[model samples]
Target chain A: MGTITVEKANELFWLGRYAERVYTTLREFFIGFDRMIEAEEAYIEYCKIVDVPNVYESKREFLEKYPFDTENPDSILSNLYRAYDNALVLRDEIHTETLSYIQLSIYDMKKARVSIAPLIEMQKVIDNLLAFWGSVDDKVDEEKTRSIIKLGRRVERIDLYLRFRMSCDKLKTEKNKLEKRIVRTGLKYDESKLCELSSMIDSGEILLNQAIALIESLVEV
Target chain B: MEQLYKQSEVVNDLLARYGVKFGIYKNGNFKEQLFPFDAIPRVITKEEFNYLERGLSQRVRALNCFLKDIYAEKKIVKDGVLPEEFLYASSGYLAECESIMPPKGIYSHISGIDLVQSKDGTWYVLEDNLRVPSGASYPMIARELCRRSSPGTFMENKVCDNRNYASLLKQVMDYSNTGGINVIMTPGRYNAAYFEHSYLAEKTGSVLVCGSDLFVEGDHLYYRDYTGKKIQVGAVYRRISDEYLDPMTFKEESVIGVPNIMKVYKKGNVALINAPGNGIADDKGIYYFVPKMIQYYLGEESVLNNASTYLPFYQKDMEYVLENFDKLVIKDVAEAGGYGVVFGSSFTKEKKEDFIELLKREPRRFIAQEVIDFIDIDIMEGDQQVPRKADLRAFVLTGEDTYVWKSGLTRFSRNPDSFIVNSSQGGGFKDTWVLSQ
Candidate 1:
């Protein structure tokens, strides 16, 4: 692989973050969606957990708009579009085959928006996302490129896990993974913040807002 | 062939999946649209390919010679073969590039020569795209997907592989490199040919960069890596136009342009592929003088024929254009990509008079050509075969030698009544196949 410019490195980092954001949120939406089928206003709690505004008024509105609305920047479709935007520019770094999976994911997201049975199409979106990551690992030969994206993926996954209030074991596993991955990326980060997050994770008591803030600012492009 | 045609949708789906798209600005809004692909390949026989190979190489070589001479001595203009007015009035001609020879004395390294075949089977050169010619990636990628769709179709036929466009491109850059690395510079992802730029960079193993990623220091163009280490760039295949390449040299207001890069180029510290000031060679007005340029420079008759073109700047040609106003197509020399083009026959009487007045006032700004009835190729429209006008854009790569890629881009108008086949004008493309047998 040739030299990676600062601009391309920034794009690679965001591509990883956005792809993981779509994948994790889609999964969370699925779980909340099932709960909504039995209890109409379950999406209210779902919004609070995901830290997005409760813009939808009714169960039908949430079901129809939360996953598909492009105007809402927090929607699954919007995040998927962001992932596509980042991946589109990183074609040389990620390779075309890996980039195609993101393109395919966007297509599936669009198809899901109109379908009566949208889960089938959304499932395909998740499958393509998985394939995108797998292709990145298999085809992206540049160790730094792979590590940067992996760093982004690790950061985003831990952020989402903290938001969902997952178990202490889950947090430690992801936190450890992030600590190992960040060093390999060759990107500059605030080491003190990462150490602070480690202490928080090790203490078995985490402040949600402070931890998410630390993770967001840990890496510098 | 039938097998390939039947799998058109599958192939198209793959194109979309891979984001094989071109961006266009519609009403000041940028939209990336899928360039529709017709599965039926445009096959050229080995004999025909060989003929085109010779003619295209000859034409590109002459154009390169013309570029070298026009900037150095203006010999052709002095010898009365080409008028000085055409050279000076051309918007493509840059005074900044005068007398500064490129690294290899090569201009127009990768030329996209557009051609159309008449119904009578004679091919006519339509235009020469010397500066930033694109669409090679469309056919190259399409060929890959076509083979994937119908491997049996390819196995049964003897088609020359066109997948070596990257290596050919690499050779062009490598041969032109002064010392260090090769990079493909793009304006941004929003540009129409961004897909080609990035894909070619990936294929050629060159770093893809934008203007902000590069800087000039001590008479050298350097690419700054993420680590803040500066790597010297010996050659840059810049996809942006000349005017937007160096803000200090061309368009000072252009934020996308690298400052002082032209200073590096002028000093022979770096090479710019297809070199700046190349637009002067491919100017629509200069295109009328290419055959004469071939004779004047090479002392040989042009191997290819240009369309019957007339410059209204000349008295005799002006009279001929005025007399046959309805039979010619008028084009603005400054415009491109199907814009500023008017079919004379389509004009009303009042519009014709108004245009004639404008033509007489700015005769040097326009050229007239006899509208040839080009041959049509069948394209699939909902399982039905329909004929549409098409033109071929053949790529010629000049490195140690001038090479014509065996395959070309065959673009056809989607509209039944239209002659314009620009992707921006809603045209579809077919993969051009050069038959080995």
Candidate 2:
């Protein structure tokens, strides 16, 4: 076995982030989709919450395009493709069975044509992503590799939770996981900035803009 | 075999699920295409496999000896067994590799020798791929999937288990290891054979690295890891071509090459699998001399025969080629992967005349071969079994000893009338079953 190079580390980190981004956003898309069926403009609010441009004319259009659009950089398919691109290079470190989940998700997203059917079809995507995480934890033997990937996953989850306005407690749990992985991986980070972000989150004085900035700046991997 | 054919669709689905694909560039855009797998395997009886084993081993050993001799003593050239002009005129003969002996004195550690069986049951060697030969993983993984699809078929048949190709590969790498970790160096994921590179690395417990992941420092090759730790690389199974291996030595424009890697290799600090400059032996022009090489180096009759070949470089052979222009297949020595091959019968009268003129003007640039009427194998086309042109690529590994993998890659052309069966030429592959009894 070879030591993970800095370039590989960056890829692993981004792989985790993109995989989690697809999973979390797909779940969020389901909720937005259900609401969009009742109101045509509900998806615009959802796009605003996720910080993506509300390019679609209506909620129905957003539901039709967001999950499978290749052109939209923030679409579920794009994130899944990015996840696959990153995982493809790390096959030596990541088990194939684990990587297969991401591949299946990409395939499912591409095959999905009926707009509403994909909202339910994405359940397989969710299952695969969860299985992918479990496989990473169980199958990956390298400490640094697992830690680096988990760090990316947790950081992306925290960013998504904050943007989607999940409970502060949930955000805290995700942040705590990220912090542990950061320490375990021994990746360089701004320790003071991390502590300041934690204090602001704990004290309930955190501005959304400032917290997002701090989270983005926490790790440079 | 019937059960395997019945379950072909399911097996193909599984292959796609596992992402068994090869990438190709079309109009300068990269596209990954699934390498279709045919359920009906090409069965080789134990007796036939034994013959192939000996022939492939003997042929590869002679080629290795030829490489070592040409690089060191030039004895074959001096003894008049091989012409000095042929040795020097070939572009594959790297001058920089002169007098530098690789670890274990092995040049072609892994050889993929392409062969075709004629209708008369005679096996003829078609080409020798000594440099970064691929397609072993295709059959290796195909067998895995096939066995899973029909366990009863495998149980009923006394076929040699080919799952040990990974272990065999590991052994070769281990035998060639001079010091540190073994690594499979790739240009990147975009290369045509990137899947094989990564799959072999995963199976052999070697690191799969790109050029930037590796560097040479103080006469040793090292792999830089994510945490900024450097691991020394003892042996490298580099998948890139010779000209793109080391930027400082060969192609200076290659961004995929590790600088000064040849320096580390030259100093004997690291082992390069199928050591560089092996293209000299695999060159199409040099192929005409392999049987002679076996006779000269091993002092034995060649077990395998080269396809009936005529070198245009020789005056008598050139005359024969000219007379038999409409029946022979002419090949450019510089090209491979089923390229640069022209069947004389397929050409127009004017085109044939033009090709003959080119051959006459530059006799050293081409070789002509009698078109062998190779046997066709049955492959499932929809629900019907059809015969298609196919060829086997037998892999020979040289380590502490020379060993030929029992099973080989059987690639068949999908087009019924097409003779070319390279994957790059839209051919699909079948599992080669070498029966134990």
Best by lDDT: 1
Cα error of candidate 1 at position B152, Å: 1.1
Chain A TM-scores for all candidates read 0.98, 0.96
The sequence of per-residue lDDT tens digits that candidate 1 reaches over residues B1-437 is: 89999999999999999889999998999999999999988888999888899899999999999999999999999999988999999999999999999998998889999999999989999999999999999999999999999999999999999999999999999999998899999999999989998888888989888999899999999999898888999999999999999999999999888999999999999989979999998899999999998899888899899999999999999999999999999999999998999999999999999999999999999999999999999999989999999999999999999999999999999999999999999999999999999
Instruction: Give the lDDT of residue A198 in candidate 1.
Output: 95
TM-score of every model versus the real structure: 0.99, 0.98
Where is model 2 more than 4 Å wrong at Cα? Answer: A114-116
lDDT tens digits, residue span B139-223, model 2: 8888888899999999999999998998999999999898999999998989888788888988898988888889999989998
What are the DockQ scores of the candidates, in order?
A: 0.82, 0.75
Q: Tell me the deviation in Å of residue B319 in model 2.
A: 1.0
Per-prediction RMSD in angstroms?
A: 0.9, 1.2
Worst 10 residues of 1 chain A by lDDT: A1-10
